[model samples]
Target: MGYKAQFHPGTSDPSKNRKKYMDPAYKLQKIRSVSDEDVVRVLGHRQPGEDYKSVHPPLEEMGEPECPIRELVEPTPGAKAGDRIRYVQFTDSVYFAPISPYQRSWMYSYRYRGMDSGTLSGRHVVEARERDVEAIAKELIESETFDAARTGIRGRTVHGHALRLDENGIMFDAMQRYVFDKSTGEVKYVKDMVGEPVPAPISVGKPLSENELKTRTTIYRADGITIKQDAEVLQMVQNVHWERSFGGFEPFKEAKF
Candidate 1:
């Protein structure tokens, strides 16, 4: 589903009540603020980063727009037509919340380069702690979604809970070179040297039904620092996300996409 931006306005303090919006990127990552009056005044413009262009001034310059909503989505449960909200959707369900809507044009430009490519896809989750790759691999292995023997990104194998047949998967890999200091037993690594993994050789073949396609297909780590691959139920995996993470969107809360 497309991202729908919602504007929330306030005078006392916008930060105190930022949780109302569903678009977490603006809140968690961007930390932008919009007032209610701005939402009611600005002309309707696509939020920055959508395939369409916006004529509005940058957030820094304009402070905030008239109407808070930027992107659009269908009204969600318990939501009214005039509700100021951001909507998060996956499959057939939509969730609504109030949040500051910020432009993501720069990110979209880098991720979807083709003129025909518009709209963002995918979502990410913010974890409480950094996930250990080795632990994640162990979980995948235990779950039995991927064969432990066949799975290895840059010689580092995933051995975690396996993914379920009905669930979609996203993979990210960071390949790095390290210099081990013999005296201190410490490894120093440069952030610039990290890169993406090579594409996987095996592909998930076409399933018998649409349900199978959605259930069996998964995204896997591939070469390049930013690019990963998506494997459909019937098609071979291809390069994707040269500039973004899996699912194209960031996750709010722990809910699965």
Candidate 2:
């Protein structure tokens, strides 16, 4: 092959983690299991076994327009079934959480289809068909990317990513959606993402060890893996910035890599 695809650049461990997460080919290691029904309950959108309410008819019923692009492309199962759009939002602590909002968007774009993502200061929200969102949420919750104490599933009032952790070692939640069980040493969610009470609390399993977080995290920090250490990544960023500046000012000049 002339040119193989490269996901991200850097020799640092965090940089390597960034590449692994963004590559669709890499299967995220599963850390725990939460039932599909439990995921539905945690979302608090529709109860388990409830029929999916739709804004438009299924594609099979109404049929798509006679466009060549539409003919060539296949719709997601949710789109074909006319499932309503739903969202799942996650808040990542700045204390070396495995993945952050920007990384989540990159990973999601690489791994999924028929979805839209919004990244903010503290949260990353992915919106897709209801069932599809549920599936994605479940996988993310049970994966190594999510530390029960660090990654929060918050649909609203997301305001604690930058704050210091509590004595219990869990990130602060304004709504107190989850609590660290002192006895079991597990993080359990008592409320839904939107701060609504769930019928029963769901356990997302134990938090990862500090060493594990340091190894798997994509964040570049002075205390951990700093960006300055990754010379390749830093140079690439500078090159891209320089190229953009030169292109904006000297449109006629041939750009250099």
Candidate 3:
């Protein structure tokens, strides 16, 4: 029999959300629309109409040795074209953000190929071929995984995930990459992800309401769904903690709750 993957363990909304986000079969809901040109501008890797710079000659053009592994493995579009590697970083607010950095790493692993992801305390960065990274950034920006208010696309100065939300309920960006538009009731990016100015403001749509955020949030909070409330998740956490703490010294002993 084929093995079935259990993405997560719990019945809570956050747990369910984590599982759903990790499952590649689940199509993430599109909550907003950001133009492809705007996506390129915000990535700050290249100009809107600029050609992708290549680190090496295209696979077909390069005189390559015939290896069995290379024959069996299919190269991604960017890889085949020998595009230079680039990255996109996202910071998720702790205050009812739909997704967190750790989960973002897991989701990216399941959903993407030919890329590497790193997770920090509050930020996640995915590195891939230049064009591939741009595609990924655009999809994630438009998907439910991103909230215009709670999620930030920051290439640097990623220090606002743990801070309190601003008066407009937007995540505090020290770079001030994005601003809340009062008249349109939307969030617009005046600068690129790395803090350079863009030609025009790129609107990423309005912020989700507090109630909507709560419903979609994958974070466990005392004010909402606490981890303590989910026995299965709590048990899993304890088991992992025990293994990491004592498994090295007491390899033969069972963990006691």
Candidate 4:
């Protein structure tokens, strides 16, 4: 008999979305298109036509290492080429953003290979080989999981996820990295992820509508869909809390909630 993985437990939209995003088998819906050049510009790690920098010589050229673990596991394209490690960080607004930092970490862990992810209160950061990070960034920017207004690609000074939105319904960025264009009603990035000025504006496309955001949002908010409404999720939360509180002292005692 084999054990199957249940990504998350709950029937609510947020729970279902969390599970979907964490499942590599589920295809993420592409909601917008950003050019590869634009992706590079936003990432600010290198120029559009610049060659990827390498940390070491290619794996094949290095030779001489015959380890059982190395033979069992296949290296990623970037790893094989020994590309330099790079990172992409995202800040998700609390106001019904499509996806939050915690879920972003979970999704990345399941979908990505040879990478590391960290989740903070307001943001998530993923580090991988340079080219691989760019590919991951582009996919996430175009996916339904990202909303231009509520989701920010910030490498540093990620401070707006918990703040109130601006007049145009865009998240408040301390760096003012992106702006809402009144003419096209689109959100454009005038600066790179780290607040460095870019040569041209990179349009990530228009923000999703309020209704659309609510539908796709993986966050459970009191104003939208409260966590209390999902019985199974609430039970799981309580159980986790109970285990954390008493498990250290009473390893054999049953949790009562």
Best by lDDT: 3
Model 2 C-alpha lDDT per residue in residues 41-151, reported as the tens digit of each score? 888889989999887899989967799988888988888889999999999999988899999999999998999999997899999998789889999988888999989
In candidate 4, list every pair of residues with a backbone clash. Answer: none
Give the Cα-based TM-score of candidate 4 against the true structure: 0.97
Residue-by-residue lDDT tens digits, candidate 4, 191-237: 99999999999888999889888889999999998999999999999
lDDT of 3 by residue, 54-104 (tens): 999999999779899999999988999999999999999999999999999
**Clashing pairs in model 2, backbone N/Cα/C closer than 3 A:** none
Each model's number of backbone clashes? 43, 0, 0, 0
lDDT of 1 by residue, 6-37 (tens): 43222112222321222345322221222322
Q: Let me know the TM-score candidate 1 reaches against the reference structure.
A: 0.16
lDDT of 4: 0.93
The Cα error of candidate 1 at residue 120, in Å, is: 18
Candidate 3 deviates by what RMSD? 1.1
RMSD of each: 22.0, 1.9, 1.1, 1.2
Model 3 residue pairs with clashes: none
Stronger candidate by lDDT (3 vs 4): 3
Any runs in candidate 1 off by more than 4 Å, and if so which? 1-57, 62-64, 68-176, 191-257
How big is the positional error of residue 139 in model 2, measured in Å on the Cα after superposition? 1.5
